[model samples]
Target chain A: MAAPAILITAFVVIGGMATALAQSLGLFPLVGPPSLTVAAYAAQASDLPVGIGLSLAIAAASTVVACLVGFTAALVIVQGRWCGKLVAALGTLTVPVPHIVGAASVSLLLADSGLLARLFNAGGSWPELVGGPWWIGVVAEYGWKESAFVALVVTGTLATRAVSYDETAALLGAGRLSRLRHVLLPLSLPTLTVSATIIFVYSLGSYEVAWLLGRAYPEPLPVMALRLFNAATLTARPEAAAVAIVTTLLSFGAVAAALAYLRRSTLWR
Target chain B: MIPAVRVEGLSKSFPGTGAPVLDDVNLTVEARSCTALLGPSGAGKSTLLRAISGLERPDAGRVLVGGQDMAGVGPEHRGMAMVQQRPLLFPHLNVLDNVAFAGTVRGVAKRAARADAAGFLELVQLAGFGPRPVAALSGGQAQRVAIARALAARPAVLLLDEPFSALDPELRSVMHDLLAQLRRSVNPTVLMVTHDRSEAAAVAEKIALFSGGRMLQHDSVERMYSRPVSLEASRLMGGANEIPGTVRNGCHHSALGALRLPGDTTWPPGPGILLVRQESIEVGPGNGPGLHATVSGLRVLGPRRLVSVDAAGVLLRAEIPWGRALAAGDTVTLSIPTSALAVVDDPDTAHTFPGAEKRPQITVQGLATLASIDN
Candidate 1:
């Protein structure tokens, strides 16, 4: 029974990748005889580097911020206090909101003429956060959505055996800061790494959030790929496929590195 | 010297429970001495330990260390260490680092802390186990490491919660000997909680008996065994053959017949329970002058035989040498010496005499054999 599902998933995923590879190598021509060439990859050499750099910067920044806030939230939730329950409930509520919707909401909150600027009466004086040179709104959307995911996963890791270990540490003369440094942080590392890698890969490949809140020039890789795929000129399709393949490779690299680190962590046992 | 640890009027209760788990508990541990908190499960012995360690805050009480009140003190600042039933060594650290943790938290240099931890490991007979992962250790070895880790802190008070209860019988004996030897050199004020009376007797100078969240008695181990405060306390310390009777004119009258009381008997004439150790009962042929009983059971236990007898509908237990060769249905005369009798006023056991209602039979044959093996 499982074989059918596995075969179908493998066929769709590998078939899609094969189609994209063929297109990127100049085959599957829409208006001419199919042929093989590296011109599609070579065409975007100048623009591809900028897109990749921007994509990596946004993903890395978003992942770091998400992990810090999410890990703190997890600690609070596992403490089993009233305010901790409230924070946990808010995180649960935030997790289900679509990224595109979160991007729209963030734009309404942080745009120069948006609600925050109106409430503060600092219109025209508010920092350029949405569609600005920095892509603050795009990073904020990804961070807000993915932080909840990280918090939920980390809370699970702590719920199992953290209490007994914490008590033992306390009895062994560890203060609050010492317990966190020695016990909580090391115990939570493997889970935090896995969650951060997921956030990085998701932010790198997601197009809708960046298109909704990003600038037209110097776009993130996903936004650049979408623009090229939708261009009136038919030849830009192969360049879009090349960008998508590069994004996939980067995500794979990040996941592999995280797994290697997890294998070496003492707490992984 | 001031008592190393003192607790006064400690009381705690959980939500939805009408009774407190620890009720007005007061205890003191002399400096450089070991006291065992002996009780059955759910008797709040472990709770008292946690309260003294500052892991649980009592609703009402005060804990003092070295004659100083610890009102606002935290566990880390109280200069106390605890060993739990499970080793609970941190999985993220090796044995050496886990042992050195308290030193690191106190801001000791890493090299010095490790050196001190190594010395402690040697003390616990795990000299070369410093660099091994905690996961690789057996149950006994892990528990030894836990003891070493707790000692590395050099605490003024050491609290252990049934630390050896998880080991095999042989390992448990080894740990008891190791602990006794360590006490001579490290000599921290130790309060160990265990349900096993023999373990307490082996390792503790004083024993505090607890039941139903109330402290029954606290005295030296020898006194606690010889003169238990009540019949329940006597049974807890392995006292057998409790005979309910009445005291009258320097003699006790019961189903076993009137017997001369000890000259030091001070009880005014009334109903009481007489306690006799199983080893104190002497058996002879049916021709002797004593209460006549028929042997109902004979169990050959290594060097001795446990003989069960029925005397005029009263059941009694006696231990004799294996050479007696008595069999079931043999008539014998049992004599309990007057000096060996300890009368107790236990209201709970007043109507629990062998012939009154139904005697609560205790199956301690296996326990006796285990105790003998330990010796």
Candidate 2:
């Protein structure tokens, strides 16, 4: 039963990638005889470096912020009183909202003349948060949306075995801080790492949030690829495929590193 | 010196329960003593242990360690350590680090704490096993490490909750001996909870019997066996036969026949329960001049034979040497010495022999009358 699904998925993904690779190597030209060349990679060499750096910075920042907030939310949901239920409900509510809708909502909320700035009557001095040089609005959109995902996954991990382990630590003479440091943190590390990897790869490849909230000078890799893929000139298509291939490789590398780290964790066994 | 631990008037009830799980319970353990809380499942033995260890807060009473009330104190601040049924070792840490955890939490240097932990491992006979991962240890070895971890804290009191229930019988015996040796060398006041009476008797100096959320009796192991205070306590302490009888003029009359009571007996003329240990009864040929009984069943248990006999219409169980060629359908004579009988007022009519048709109906008034006979 699973074999058919696996085969279909693998075929679609690998077929799509093979087509992109052929176009990226100048072997599947739209208007001329196909010839293998590295011109597509050379054409975007200057801007590709900038796009990669900007993408890494944004994904890394968003993932770090999301993980910190999400982990705290998970702890609260697992160990807290009445307020924990409220936080858990809010996280569940946030998870199903599409990223495109999230980006539009963030754009409306954080733009210079948006609701908050208008409410405070500080439109002239709203700090340029939306479409700013630092891409704060883009990072905030990803962080807000992905934090909920992290929280739900982590809550599931902790709900299984954390209470008994925490009680054992308490009986073993571990105080609140000691229990958190020795038991909860170490036990949650593998799940946290896995969730963080998902968040990093998701933010790296996502297009709508960055395009909706980011400045034009240093576009993220996904936005840059989309722009090149839609250009009027036909030669830019191969460059777009080249950028997509690089982004896929980076995401794969991150997932591999995370899996290796998870294997080495004592909690994995 | 002050007692190592004291629990006074402890009572706790869950939200939906009608009666309290722990009801006005009190217990004490002297310095350098080992006490076992013995009871059946759901008898609140473990709840009492947790309440004393500061893991559960009592509604009406307080726990005292070294005469210091532990109200509002956390388990860590109460200077007590507990070993649970599962070893509960922190899986992220090696055996040495897990054993050294309490010391490190108390702010001892890691190196010194590890050295102390090594000594504890040696005490548990796992000397070179310090660096092994906790997952690699067998069930018995993991529990041994748990004991070492509890001891490494040098706690004022130690609590164990059925710590050996998961091990095999042979490993359980080995753990019992290890605990006994550790008690001699370290001398920490210990309270262990177990449903197995033999396990409690083997490891503890004193045993506290509990049933239905109430402590029935607390006494030395010898006294708990030879002189249980109540019929319920007598049954819990392994009394196999209960004979209902009436006391009259310094003699006790029962289905087993009239027997002279001890001269010091204070039991007034009243209905009471006579408890007989299974081993105290001897079986012989039915032709002898004694209580004539027909063998109902015989079970060979290692070096002994458990023989069940029916005397007249009363069923009695006896344990005899395996050399006796006894089988079902054989006629036998049973002998019971009066000195081996422990008589007390029948607490309730819940348990009684089948042939005793004239047994008195238990009433509140009758219980009160029997209670007065003791004074």
Candidate 3:
């Protein structure tokens, strides 16, 4: 029943990757004769290390922040209180907003001379959050948006069966903290792992959020690739393809590592 | 000694529901004794058990455990353990670790708790089954592990919410035997909620009957079956026949004919219901000197046959041993001793009694033999 969707996804991803790989090898260049060479990859040697490290750091930070916040949100929501209902509503509302819109909203809220700076009356003293050295604004956008996704998925799995087990544990003399440590954490681990992997891969490959909120010196892979692809010099196209291919390989590597870890986890079953 | 658990004037009502889920309930379970909360679905039996365990807070009531008021105590501090119908074993833990959960939560070392848990596993007859993941256990084994885990806590009170109802019949019987063994060894004060009358009668010393959130009667298991307080209570306890009639002097005049009531029956002369258990009625050939009855229907129920007889215009059911051969339409005589007769106030013309009705214990040979046969 799902064969068609899976086939279409596979075809698009594989075909696009093949085209990028061919271009990175200096074949089918936009303004030059078709020729095979490693010149584009060699040209990117200077900037590739910085871009890769920045991208990995951003993705890792975002995934960690999202998982922690999302797990807490899910625990609160499953508690079935009025505040839990409010958190659930907030998560539901946040999931549908595009990452770009979230990035814009975050920049408006955290930037120097932005809403927060005016509200706190710290115009001159406000930290450089937006386009900052730490990439705070960029990571915040992805973390805030992706945490909602993680919360909803994890809440779905916990709401069904966790309550009974929790009650049973409590009846067996488990206190609140003990129950959270033994019951909730172990129960939510598998879902948290899966959502974390998804967030990491997504933040690693997405461009617009980082481009709008990041500095220009040590740009993330997606932002660097987009800038190189749009540069006026035609030779930069293959280098852009090379960066894009590297990003794809990193995402694939993250997914493969997650799957391997899940396969070995006793609770994942 | 003070009762192990005491509930007084307990009541609860959920919002948007017309009737209360539990209404002014009171009960007492003695230390080291087992009591079965017997009722139908939605009878608030489980609600009462949860309220006692501190899992549920009653709108207006006081739960006292071992003479200490448990008003603000949480479920963890109540020293109670509950085994639900589904087991709810921690899937992430192995069988040994699951059983050791209570001790570990109390800050005991893992190796020491597991060592103590090994003994509990042996009590439930699953000694070597430890070290296996909970997923590897069958339904019966899982439930046994749940019971073992609860027992490992050494709780002051154990609450069971239809723990065996989810298992197959044969497995349920095996679990009943395991409970009997546990009772002999641990002697934990127990309150179990179940809709299965037989299960209640088999495991509990006292039976508390509930209906529509009200406790009808609380008495010994023998009395609950042989002398129920009301027609509803009798029916709930698996009473097969209710002969509606009037009581005058000491005799109940009904369609089955006038029968002398037991000497200690407190029922005043008024409308009454004569409750006769099916097994209490003895059937023989027509030559016997008893009420004449024609066997109208015969049903094969396992090793026993349910014999439906028409005695004059009144019908009665009698369970006979399958070894005796008697088909439908056979002329038979049913002899019921006057001592076996019990009369309760008829709801139409009198107020039904809600308190425990204690009658003199009368052991009929057939009732004893039937119980033994079942065992």
Better-scoring candidate (lDDT), 2 or 3:
3
Displacement of the residue B196 alpha carbon in candidate 1, Å: 1.5
Q: Which rank order by lDDT, best down to worst?
A: 3, 1, 2
Prediction 2 TM-score vs. true: 0.92
Candidate 1 chain B superposition, TM-score:
0.88
lDDT of 2 by residue, A99-171 (tens): 9999899888889978788888994889888888889998899999999998899999999888878877787
lDDT per model vs. reference: 0.86, 0.86, 0.88
Best by lDDT: 3
Q: DockQ scores for all the models shown? A: 0.82, 0.69, 0.81
Ranking by DockQ: 1, 3, 2
lDDT of 2 by residue, B90-180 (tens): 8889999999998898889999999999999999999999899999999999999999998888777889999999999999999999999
Candidate 2 error regions (>4 Å):
A118-123, B1-3, B261-265, B285-292, B329-331, B347-375
* Clash pairs, model 2 backbone: none
Candidate 1 wrongly placed segments (more than 4 Å): A1-5, B1-3, B248-251, B258-269, B284-290, B298-306, B319-323, B337-339, B348-375
Please provide, for model 1 over A28-89, each residue's C-alpha lDDT reduced to its tens digit, 9 standing for 90 to 100: 76678889998888998888889889999999999998999899999999888898899899
In TM-score terms, which candidate is top? 3
Worst 10 residues of 1 chain B by lDDT: B366-375
